[model samples]
Target: MQAIVVIILILALLLVIFTLQNAMDITINVFFWEIKDAPLVIVLLTCLLLGYLIASFYFFPKLWKLKREYKQMIKFNSELKELHELNHKNDRKPVDDNSDPEGIELDDDDNDGSTFFKD
Candidate 1:
């Protein structure tokens, strides 16, 4: 970013020098109207500004559409994540209060599903 700013400043300095050197007066003929004895520097700068504005008009609509699409995708991804979390919450089985922490489930049955215990 700093480099870009430095380059722009250098270009602007060069443009100033070029404009000063080319300061000859010139006449412009528009449709049924004539502009007389305008400075070359002002003409060049005006043309540059107009060209920048025209190019921005060409590109800004597409840029705005892409930005809108990016925001929509982000919203969709967040909704999808929320739904996934909700699904995981619903899919979980309810814990039994009588179940052992060691994962061993003991009922009345013993060996061979028999309730009798030998002493």
Candidate 2:
């Protein structure tokens, strides 16, 4: 913040110096309209301000769309993370090593493809 203020002060000083040095009167003509005895500093500053406004207006919609997309992506990412966490929590079921869920059991000594049914 202090750095920004210092930079702004320096720019203001430079602008004051420039305005004092270029305090000349000039005439401007556009089509049939004529502007007489206009200060060079004011005209230049006005042109700069107009250019800044024009550029800002030209890019405002694109900037707004990018912000909207960024917010939507953040929301989607959070939802996906929550869904993954929910699935991970629900998948923590205990397993039984000794008992099989199916009734059929395989015999280790027999090489034949035969399954024994539990009694």
Q: How many residue pairs clash per model?
A: 0, 0
Query: What is the per-residue lDDT of model 2 for residues 1-119, given as tens digits with 9 covering 90 to 100?
Result: 99999999999999999999999999999899999999999999999999999999999999999999999999999999999999899788777686656946654674665647532
What's the distance in Å from true for residue 4, model 1? 5.9
Candidate 1 lDDT tens digits, 25-119: 99988799899999988988899999999999999999999999999999999999999999899799998999999999767646566455544
- Note the Cα lDDT for every prediction shown: 0.92, 0.92
- Where does the lowest 10-residue lDDT sum fall in candidate 1? 110-119
